[model samples]
Target: MCFVAAVVWSLWSAWHLPSWDRQMDLHVYIGAVRAVGDGVPLYEYVAENGDPFTYPPFALAVFQPLGWMSEPVARLVWLGATPVAVVSIAAALTTRRGIVGRRRQVTLTLVAAAVLMVSAPIQSNLRFGQVSVFLVLLAFVDALDLTPRPVRGVLIGVASAIKLTPLLFVPYLWVTGRRRDAMRAGASFAACTGLAHVMWPAASTTFWTDAIFSTSRIGNLAANGNQSLNGALIRVGVVPPERAAAWLVLSALVCAVALVGARQCHREGHTARGVVVVGCATVVASPVSWTHHQVWPVLAGLLLMAGPRRTRMAWGVVLLVAMTFSVGGWLPAGFARENVRLLAALAVCTWGLAPLRHRAPATVGLLPGVRLVVRPRTAMAYAGVVAVAAGAVMLLVRESPVAVRFETPDHRDEALWGAPTNGCEGYTSTLRADGTVGYACESAVDPVGGRQLNFGGGRGGSSGMVTIQGQVGPEVARLVFVPVEGTKALDVPLLPQPGPGSAPLRAPEHGRPEMITSGPIEDRRLPGARGFSIAATSTDHALLLAYGRDGRLISSGGEKLRMG
Candidate 1:
């Protein structure tokens, strides 16, 4: 009870009192629910911070009730629920096969919960008010067979419906000879997904057809928080065109090794080890496994410590869990440093499976009359050869082009749009198919060239207002909209766009020469790219004039307006 108190108190201290406005994934969830209530299409709902609803429509349906509550109330409820979920996770893991005494079980659960609270992943989940903790708890309960047989797989199914990664467990159960449970999970998943289709027809169609494959909907996969194998490849400068191919090849290899290792562990009566093995593989294979998604490593370490004492495997698990605490963040930032977590996960997979190498029977060579004995080691060697062959097939793979889509203002249907570009690249806006405008960049590497300005507006469908948005070059220090009717000009400041890493522009070191500029400046240097948006009445028309830092006119452009 004291440990549980510590967990709650830790969360309260971290969250602070009387203020719950810290950021990220939770806002996306709240925005998603609000978008549904407003009758907006799920895919079209971008939170104020520019994140979209990346999960399936089933997730949106599950979260719909959150819409009824005010943001503060919802956040409070979510914050309170997170600790309960964490405690439940610890209880589920500890009580799976039963610990000796009631006292020992309670003690173990409390200790595990406290340790989990300190993990970087769980901390991130709490800070963001993310659903990951609950998802992890659900996976743990179902995977460890804590639930009754008839309803055994329901939680895993529901979890996968909310976030696609848990689907890996369905196959894990099947391959481990739990076919009945796998079928139950599959059927439950289909039922939930089918219901979501009935509730949100267009969103379901759009998601299955397009959104599932569009990596752009999620933030930059190369960001440091992303600790997946695909993320590691991306950070190391894998070319864009071949990324999908490489990801497919590597994901397949990892999944094969993981499934084999997990099956072996399950056969050896080490179910916890099997679950941990599969969990690590799922994190590595997924394209956008964020730091908060690493709940599996925490489970692995806890489960290993619960087993026999003083083994090298137990020490390896300790090393793995310590890595999950994220000492890597203190290291110098680069490709290698960025991939520390990914490498640790890969190490967990390898070391967890290392025992299989020695457990295999030792046989000399093939005889003419006798059959060749293929050991686990030899089987693994064959698997590696197959993996290499499959990767070699990447040279022949051809990718089909896919477009990102946004819902029309009417909320009736979606319109295809080009994906957003890195801020350093030049921006271009075009009237796309279905009458919606789209923007694309020329290159991801080249900096924005020359002073450029472009403006466009769309009729605000049912709201009857107008949304005017445009892009300005780095040189544009001031922009004004002068109404053709001689009304007063409206001054709109160009906001500096963050670069590729979404990092803010920084000033030079203290001793550097001052950058010369005129007019009010937000930073010492003007960003290489900037933009602005204005909300106005439909009847308004204005000429856009941009000025330089020295107060000289940079460019003048006419508003290219689109009618409803």
Candidate 2:
């Protein structure tokens, strides 16, 4: 079943071949590798797309062979290799103890790989042709191996040399009473770094001395795609100036707690579970963990599934995985973007660490009138149950009633409604019958003078005592306003009008006002009296906001206006 699923997935992925060249991060890696091979100074070269090579110099060496191949061929090879790496990791995790048969081992490995491919993190990794899968496999093998300490350490060292995040595992080794392995891993890491320095002194110097700490090179740390605790706090309205200190304190606390849990798991003969927990903690504690860095949670889920049955931890893992797989349009934009997955990872770490009693073993029939104690049927059963539950939840969320609906204004309409409130407060929009929309947003000041609006998943938000107006056109609504106080008013187009019955409109192209073609106004029931609602996408970003007859600002779902 696993092999069949993997083959189908691979064929489908191959059918979408045009996207191979569009893997931005893979291009960055390829560029660095070519630069290294050509002796053109790796750190000094930037790709045409404005992305800099941010990985360690040794990573260039690791990927150097790809530079020799044509771009298409390299991409195909990389794509194919990812599934192999995923399968390898699964094999190591599932077959290490040698209790399972060879056929069962292969089936389990393929099944694990297939399930992971559906997750958002793995999807993102494959989309970008990232090395995350290979790195994950290396770390998993090192952490779960019962071999000599040096071999385990070497695997982790090689992984760390390619990407700095895996360095977190070295300390994990020490904390879990594997001091020799930790020391060997540290030495191996140093040796690789030293080798890189020898091969490309200039790039090595620049990376170690500056690039390693330059978060800007990696793009916006506070971007919605960054799922770290720091990113979450930033999304929740934490100011930039204090966000670093806040992240430091919070990351420390999370690490301390997670380490304690991981240590417990390690001592309890669940090394794989411990390693997975540590991996999750590392991602959560990092300053900027992209969506692809979240593979650890999936690993934890698999571990729980293959562990003892009828336990709370097992059920919790099932629910967590199910929730993650079910995540989609039903969630608030911000929550859907990153928070939900991050929360799942945190939950896995926490649950894995908790001290829960194991359930009694179940007996299964091996022969006539003969029963043998064994674990729950297999991870496949757990996956099947979760898949069914997730499908049901998705159906319900999709068919649920609209949260808010707007009423179309007749000739003249005047109503006041609060802003679509989420994470921020104190802003309102008013729709006038004169084909005009007015906003009376409170100034970004209360006790402290700063913006209070935390537009989590939206393109952005505005603050301060500001008054802005826009004329609603026959086909498009042009919103003109300055984002900050004392700035000139900028004209921006609203989304194309949506159809009736509260149906969602397709996202409009950015900066293309001509593309803002109008559609029939949705005739949805309002909370109060009859009024028309105009649903439109935000021009600045892929955001959906609706304005109703009153001052109703409806986001993903409509909200009842509170008349003041």
Candidate 3:
């Protein structure tokens, strides 16, 4: 059954791969390495889509080869490797400790891999081209006996060097009766950090001192995609100062509880369960755990199924349903639903870590009497159960479609790029009913008769020319760029819209999904919005003046037109 589900999912993913914006994070990874190669400051280098490099300096070094590859090649390599990592994780979880015979273990590993491939978090990782699954597999080396005992924790350390979250495992290894492995892991981490420092001293220093604490660089902490406890609290209206304190307190408490639970699980031989518990704790405690980082929950769900029959029927259902469905969306509070993954991880730690009164049998498969091959008599019964469960998930879960539908004014470039199309960095589409999206730099200018001028500019290349891009309001017929020092005024050209027979705008082949483009429409002249994209030869401040059709000044802003 799981194999069938996996095959179906593979087909579906392949079909949608072309339409979906693929591997945004992978681009950042490659871009960061390339930035270093180009002599750009690692932390200061921003991707074309406006994301800064947030990973450790060592990560850049690791991705240096990927930087040499073209975007398509890098994406292909990442997408292919991610599934292999998932399969490896499943194999490590199922095949270790010899719970079953070799053949049974192989079968169980395949089944687990199938279930994991279809899980929501894994799918999210694949979509974003994230490295969470690979890190998970790396952290499992010691626990699953996948490497030599002498170097069991080295991989965990290396993973930590790429990302700090796995560093939590060093102490975990210590308390779980692997003190030597813990020291080795810590030493390995230090060695990797030192290597990065030697390779790129300035970048390593910047990341360790400044960039590490700049959580905002990763994007909005309270965004729906952030499923950590800190993000959850912020969405619920906690101020930053108080949120910091509360988060620290809550994270400490969770870490304590989860660590204790993991220790118990480790001592009791449920090593995989223990590792997952620690991983869940890490996700919840982190300041920004994106949906892709919640991969541990799927593994937790699988482990939950391995418990006794009643426990499997009760807790197992609760977890798998929560994992499969967006449970937070059903809540009354708007932001509460966004933290469904966070809440689910907490629940997993709560159940997986709590001590048991009686020692349960360590059967690492599905419920008893459930076999890989079913008899003719029971085949119909299993099929009925599977059908009912599938039906329930289909009825209850409402997946947000990847497709976006919004009509921009004038409809020249119908497809908008980068999310939150508020017109700051590039030519963003605006509705222009009454409100301005605000200036690209500072100072907000009020809309004039439901008209807005959204403008931004920056240094283009080594030539030092500044490329300015903006969208002018329909109320303005003539737009002029006046240099703060020069006498000549450059007339900003308005981009023309597509004619009647022009091809309809299509979604991007590679990039983020089309952002929301529809804004309030009150003014009749809003449909005539025009774009301004020009290279300023001189790097100087300029004033943008918008003139109405009646030869009257519509709007003007000087600070908004500064050439960076």
Candidate 4:
């Protein structure tokens, strides 16, 4: 039933969403992989013309299977594989075959499901085609038994070669005194990393010498680039991006000190549960988390529930909250983004401030919070049950129907580029000024009224640019006129403003006017160029957009044309 519910909910949400991310992040990357496997070059992987990806050659192996199906179906396969991989890992960590009993199964399932639901960052991974889940899962599976310790080490080694973030978990594992596991992880990580280097010699060389070294030094990014709790805090006027990193480091140090203090000062419990707690926080310390990347704590909470009792129940509740936000809450409800950061921070604090020896057995001795105080085996069973139940919920969500639809404006009259009837007449555009024939409705563009512009997905909650195509040379006709909010937008010399020694297209000195455009936008990196891309709904509560070929290529912001 839970599975059915998850399926239903997911389907419903998918259908009703005003605009889906449409594999914006990793989805596009995966799509790129598909293209590559089909013998397409990276240059050909355009979103409009093809897919979006520029992965290392190693990713080629991963994307090869995608070629067996159409793009949409391939995307589904890539996306659909996530739940299975994720839930299975959760079950392995928190629940096992001989772990728990039948009686407590339902409770375990419900709680586990709730926690999994709350894992906000995990969704980001999926949102971006990050594949971090698989990375974490490999480690999670490797960490399971003492027997596989060596192999797990090797896997970590390989994964580390691919992405640096996975390397963070190494200290946690090593500090626990599992030297052999760490060694294996190191070895595997090294081998895989070295292999990646050997295969993508150019990228590998550039990554270490350029990207990695540069990343190590440059600690902050723009608000839009930040994905951490610290980063989000920085975004909402809390702190500067670079300052936030300093504060984060200071805070982590303080927590480490506090955890030591808690060990010597208070003999309180939750030390075991706290271990996983801090793991989540560690993730939030980075600026790269999207939705799926945040799942560390949810997985940790599940494992904790199967560990000691003092804080597991509370942690379980936290999981529920995270899960709630991940599903539909990430959007629609405005608070989901910040809420996710808060939950992750709390987990980090919980673990960081608690005193637990890494090498300590993760057994449930049960000092508090368990009604029956079940045995370790029963606890394991309960945890497994919880994971399965949670998985079921995920499935049900995928199947559910949309409850209510957000209002979608009519778009029927909108001109279709290639459509037969409404097809825009391709013309060798003439550049004219004086706001005369060049800016006229029929000649330059229709000044066409259509539904308000709505970009499917844009960062920072705003829509993308509103684009309309026409013929105009920066020399004569560069003003992109648009009917914005009922008033005419005689957007000034909107092409690249005259560079040094070049002509200058200045905005009018008088009334409010759209920003100026200057310069030719020669190379369009992403597809959907040429055709106008409607960015956002304008202030007039109507629309805003650019016009003409030269109109799109404004060199105003020093932006290199977006490399497709």
Candidate 5:
């Protein structure tokens, strides 16, 4: 309870914070609900009332209650509650007969902290009003042994229906010779998903058509080019992702084979750590999971340590490194791209199955089953203790000040934009001496280069009137600054053409001529390049130099921002 309390508090402290680089998916779920309440359809082509539903159907269902409350209020409720649920899961699986020893307790504490520190970027989701942990925890409950046979089966099925990723576990259950278990769970899941659909067709329809489609939309995002294995392949070779499905299928098949072997390893009385294998299998089965998504592996690591604490050490170090990099934002865009996230997931799987390396599964379960027996090791094992204790530390330490500074306007703001964040990066808007205020992308952070957006104010939606409050005085005029990425240059194609309501303005950054230029800038066709990039210069000023196809600047003066 103390550990859980600590985690909950940490999350609460981070509540309602906004970050531009992180908190990608978390906002989408909550924002869609707000939009639904505001009369927007789930998957509107033009971002639907400025709320994008880019999550699974079950994700939307989970947010129904949130829709009734204000965004800030809902974020507070979630931040305070979800970590407790996560810790409860850790406790449920690690505690034997509901009794925890000092060593195990410490291990849990460390593991929790480590998760917070390493996956601090995940904190972005929590602060920005996201609900990823719920899905993660729900799926975990499905795999636990706390329920009756029938109830357990349904739980797994329902979890799978919510996020197709959990489907990764089915092969493990089957290979571990839990075929019947899989069927029962599948039945329950089918029923839950069907029931939800029948009861809420609007949400269901939008999820299948819009929300679900949003996830796959990543294939086209330049930011993804840095964050996922799917992106890595296309990036390294400069080719279309032709082998992704095949690779995913192959990985699943391997896990299936491993599952069968792990089952046999269990049946043959190998070792006592099959608990770890089950967890690792879950990770290896998926392709694009993030660090927080891998937290459950700690449970698998604990199970391995419970017996002979051998295999987990190597992988634990590997995992710690993986997570540390993830949270620091030091991880390159290709961090998730290189299958590192998959490796972390695999670490858990290895630990879960470690016991099977020593003894048969039935024998292992029997030993723990005997009410009078106590396992020799109680969490004093070196690696397990470190993992959990580090996690606990994370709960208390708070990420570096830099992390706090990277935040967004608020959770509600992040919620307005889904993944790819769609040119909604940070903003550079200020009232000039001329009285006419200007808005532009926060280029210092490279917001536009990543297919992400960097804008200012408002609920953080692309079109929401950007309202800058407080010290800035009453409210400056709101200018919507959109982000464009990739091409290294932007050609006006046509500049400040005399339009109905659009005005000319100057860019403070380049000291470019103000919107009221004295002379006409040259008009020419824009040169093409590798891709595209976007910048919101004051619509007021004429674009002097346009970035050309060869990555060169063509303009009146020689002012240029080079693409690296």
Candidate 6:
């Protein structure tokens, strides 16, 4: 019942909500598919949302069938697939040897799927129409299946072909003694690449030669949403030169520990736990693991809870994983958010590292049919592998070119307009790089009765309010805006757009413009006002400035602004 309810709610939300806010990523996929069908260059074409095609060319072929359908139908199909994928993964995980009784397994699958559907990551996946859930399902099924080597390899290979991250599982399979499966996975990946080349040779060349290495095409790596170790380091002021080496060392360590733990679990007949451990490692080691990619830890949490012992520690691990998605923001910024996810993943690995105890014949009903067997050679083998892999990675990082500093691209013409300030409250308008404008405003008198304004025009215009355009120069931009209901419009100029190299303009104090260190200047001067001033502390900051009738600063108020 809960699962049904969740699915119903997801479907309803997908259908009723505005297209711009939800299923946006799905629209990208659909656009990519349509581009392929229309013989358009994949990497060059932007989607409706101004995002370029980021997925591999092979993924286009996979989603190409959807191009034939109408957009609404395709969206419905995509949204509907998420719940099915979640349920399928849950079913696959629960159908294993230790989970006794069909009814109990089904119940657990339904409950877990329902709970996960409402979780933050899954909700984010649905909201953005992302393919992370499908990727998770593919990976989990490939890892847990006791099927023949080729089948598992094909699943992992296909997933990796769609998105590069699943390639991590190939090494994992090899380390776990699934060498044949690893070879097959490589072959399958090669086959997919060959197919892509055959299908779209030009796109294949462009993607493989250029687009694949350009990580900036995705977005800002240090943004808060990026939960990877690299992102965390960058957020805490780690320079790019040191960040690459640091990431290599940290990722190598995580990979070694996770693989060793997984091998130990598998040797001890805990295959499910082993798979989950490797999955957790994949997310942690990736260079850009977004929050939606956290489906692995969620799956690992469910698997841990299903274990026979169900100890306080097991439940605690599950709770920690849950908290990663729930109250993650409560922790301080930088490493704190990344640490929450990392710690949960480490806890899952630790669970796998626990010594397995042999079950008596009577107690075999609770455990899997296999007995707990210890093998020291397997440990030594993994230890040797870890040593070699870590050495290779460190060597590569040391020899690789110096990491390039990342810079935010200048969007000088981009001016965000706030709604007409009516007694200290108004709406904010954002101008996207693609020249699209979005406006949302709320009135001070009636907070609930805010109006959303619509403004049109490309990147060029004049100074007057009648034009409602933006005149952006290298240092300053003049933005003219008209009220939603009123005829009068206002021109607000912002000096020096926000970026690394822009100079800061200080707020006027005592009829003088106080110069400050470099930063963006927010000029909120109106036609007639008493005075204005800007104040800044190490942490807290505020700005207040007034203009005279002749556009000269007559008076100033508020605290003096400080520059760091």
* TM-score (all chains, Cα) for each model: 0.67, 0.61, 0.63, 0.53, 0.55, 0.63
Give per-candidate clash totals.
0, 14, 1, 81, 72, 7
What CA RMSD would candidate 2 show? Answer: 17.2
CA error at residue 453 for candidate 4, angstroms: 28
- 2 or 3, which is superior by lDDT? 3
Name the candidate that leads on TM-score.
1
Put down candidate 6 lDDT per residue, 1-564, tens digits, no spaces.
Answer: 999998888677766777578788888888888776777788876664446788888988888877889988887788888899989887877775467788988898898888788766787788888888898887778877655655777788888988888887887687666777777888888899889999999999999999886553565565656666666555554444555677777777667667656766776777777777888777777877777787877777666566567584476465535634555666675455546665665555534433323321111111235533434445445645764764465445332111111111232222222221221123344454568554332221221222111122221124211122111222111222222101122334432223222233342232223222222233322222111111111111111222322222222211321121
Query: Runs in model 4 with CA error above 4 Å?
Result: 11-20, 34-61, 67-69, 96-98, 102-130, 211-230, 236-248, 251-275, 300-312, 326-343, 346-493, 496-564
> Worst lDDT window (10 residues) for model 6?
531-540
lDDT per residue as tens, model 2, 1-564: 766575567546643757534566887888778866776677666676556787898888898888889887887787777777777767777765354588877777787777777666776777788888788888878877655654768889989999988887887787676777887889989999999999889999999998887554565555667778777765554443355566676566556546556666776677777788888887888877887788887777777677566585566566446434655445766544557767766666655543322423334333457765533223224434653554354334322111222222222112322332111112334454676544332222121322111122211123111112212322112222222111122333332222233444331333233224332222321111111222222212112222322212212111111010
How far is 167's C-alpha from truth in model 1 (Å)? 0.6
Q: Report how far residue 85 has shifted in candidate 3, in Å.
A: 0.9
Off by over 4 Å in 6: 146-150, 307-325, 332-334, 337-339, 350-564
lDDT of 3: 0.66
Q: Please provide, for model 5 over 372-438, each residue's C-alpha lDDT reduced to its tens digit, 9 standing for 90 to 100.
A: 2222133113334553554354334322111001113332233333332212123444555568655
Model 3 agreement with the true structure over 304-411: per-residue lDDT tens digits? 776656766577667777766677667887644677778778866645544432343232212345423213223334434653554354334322221112223434
Tell me the spans in candidate 1 whose CA falls farther than 4 Å from its real position. 17-23, 307-324, 329-336, 361-375, 383-564
lDDT of 1 by residue, 1-564 (tens): 667666766677557733444646787888888877788788877666556788999998778878788877877788788778888988877776468999998888888888777777887787777888788888778987889988988889999999999999998887677777888999989999999999999999999999897664575676778888777655654434466677877787777667767777777777777877888888889988887798887777776666566675576566556645666766787655777777667656655533557656533222335543436676667767875775455434422222111222232221212222234333344455568544433322222455467655665455444555556766666776543312234567555555444544232233123321211112222246665655545323334566666444456654354232
Query: Using lDDT as the measure, what is the rank order of every candidate, best first?
Result: 1, 3, 6, 2, 5, 4
The TM-score, computed over Cα atoms with residue i paired to residue i, of candidate 3 is 0.63
List runs of model 2 lying over 4 Å from the truth: 14-17, 37-40, 96-98, 146-149, 311-328, 332-338, 353-564
Identify the runs in model 5 with alpha carbons over 4 angstroms from their true place. Answer: 1-9, 19-27, 45-51, 96-125, 200-228, 261-287, 300-311, 325-339, 346-495, 498-564
What's model 4's overall lDDT?
0.42
